[model samples]
Target: MAAGCFYVSCLALGSLGSICLLFTAYWMHAWRGGFAWDKTLHMFNWHPVLMVAGMVVLYGAASLVYRLPQSWVGPKMPWKVLHAALHLAAFILTVLGLFAVFQYHNQQKIANLYSLHSWLGITTVFLFACQWCLGFSVFLLPWASEWLRALLKPFHVFFGASILSLAMASVISGINEKLIFSLKNSTHQYSTLPSEAVFANCTGMLVVVFGLAVLYILLASPWKRPELGILTDRQPLLHDKE
Candidate 1:
């Protein structure tokens, strides 16, 4: 029950973060006075941080099931280590990135940082995809050879860590951007862009939706059933004994 509640909370936070990002993007669009791709990209600056946090919490809750002795399922070895590492990395990156974004001040140096941050964020997302795929595959194919399973384990763990580091960079860069924007418009009393708040809200809501979708998929997966014999010609152990 605690795990379930944690999972739900994670989903809620993720959703909220997404909504904030969407809102930020909308504000950028309205302020810029044009539907520019560059502006849209800038708006996406907030996503990596929120995503990292959401993933961290989501995985953390799932780990609880594995940790409990009575409820534990599947072989536990390097997988547990890898899982823990990924979660830790995710948390670190998410927190760092959020800090960086909140502290951002737009300047030439900051701009360069933003560029580097964007690349890192993109890389992190890619790694995250790989990790998720590998994890799901392992869950489904528990009977597979240890060697093959082990090969994918490192990829998941290492990539997850890399993603976290990158997410931290991305957040810092985003904050710098915000700071720069503020400095540049010091003389302005109010934003010229109409509906800036509305846009930000919209973007944030979208992010929430995306996070919820991810959580739903993870929770809905049939991890309890082993895939090997479910669809094969293998008979029950009792029949084989006979």
Candidate 2:
């Protein structure tokens, strides 16, 4: 019952996070007004929308591959495949989101990768690509040598958690930078909580909440998925060479 509740809470927070991002993008930014690279500033809005949805939310879901109790209830192949596939989709969306930003910057003549957020964002994306490429070529294969998979598994999981943290940090920094740069007024800036500022702050907080919930479930002791059937031992937190 508790595990079920945790899973439910994960989904609940995930939904709330998505709503926060969507509200900021649609209502706060007025994205529907126009979406074009040419002076329709709204086009840049999709960059945040897609990145939040892809890198943060979908990636979070994919990271819960083993945490999903349903995964342990059945053959691991389907769950493994789903994990890789969802990560692939998230990676593609992230690329598109990054491309949108680069295109917008080029069209608007804004300097690229000139901010901390951009630097972190680029590094996170590159790391994600490397992680995916290695995982796809190794673990996803039917004939992976068991010792090799076991040897690399610990690094794989560790790096996965680290990459997610980096992605989250980049997002928070990006949100802060955007609010600071865009929220302009002699009388009131982000501190005063204009409607956009309020929404953006809430959006950032929502993502943070989502990250905590997902990570807690991933790392918590009792919540860890138990092996099925003959393998009754809990998996080691880190793989040890035999």
Candidate 3:
């Protein structure tokens, strides 16, 4: 029953994350116009699309690498590598997303990093980078002692989940900020609850739901990765081979 529930939760989490990505992409394409680097507003659209793809969806997926049951029988090194690689990719995309926004602001003569959304977004990225570096050094590197790894493990997991929370909050605020700015002057003002506004609101809600689902999966004791005594016993052999 526990295994079944874990799989079910994983499916739901994947679906929610995919939908959030799609909704963000659709909003940018259908209402805000398609993305392009030369076009400032369109370039701005890439900010949300890439951020949603990288920071929210991909980041959430990476955090679940160890919890998948199919990999329970094998050495965990591969999974660790995969998790780190995914995070590296996500971090790169997130940086590009930030660059797109900054470029847009520069082109438009708009002030940068001046909003609540920007504050949260930049902080999340900074912390996420730090988290990834620390995890890589302690977990993946060869020199770290078991005592140090165990000592840092709790903090690594804590910040992993916390960074996701911060990311979701940043995205939510960004959605609201975009909607307010985009709709304030047009015929379909924000006060009137325009179609774009409605779609964006739905997207934001989906993001929140997805974030909650990820947290639930991470926090559930039943779904946590089991310790691999076999692998631990083979550590000496593995190190000698390395």
Q: How many clashes in each structure?
A: 24, 0, 0
Among all windows of 10 consecutive residues in model 1, the one with the lowest summed lDDT is 233-242
Better of 2 and 3 by lDDT: 3
What lDDT score goes with residue 122 in model 3? 96
Summarize candidate 3's per-residue lDDT along 1-242 as a digit string, tens digits: 55566667888889889999999999999999889997389999999999999999999999998777656666778888999999999999999999999998999999988889999999999999999999899899889999999899999999999999999999999999999988888988898998999999999999999988888878876566666534443122222321
Off by over 4 Å in 2: 31-34, 37-40, 185-187, 227-242
- How do the candidates rank by TM-score, highest first? 3, 2, 1
Q: Each prediction's Cα lDDT score?
A: 0.46, 0.76, 0.88
- Over the full model, what C-alpha lDDT does candidate 1 score relative to the true structure? 0.46
Model 1 residue runs over 4 Å out of place are: 34-115, 122-144, 178-242
Which of the numbered candidates is closest to the native, going by highest lDDT? 3
RMSD of each: 11.9, 5.2, 5.9
Q: Lowest lDDT 10-mer window, candidate 2? A: 233-242
Residue 70 shift from truth in candidate 2, angstroms? 2.1
lDDT, candidate 1, 181-238, per-residue tens: 5445555422543244344334534544544444443344332222333422321221
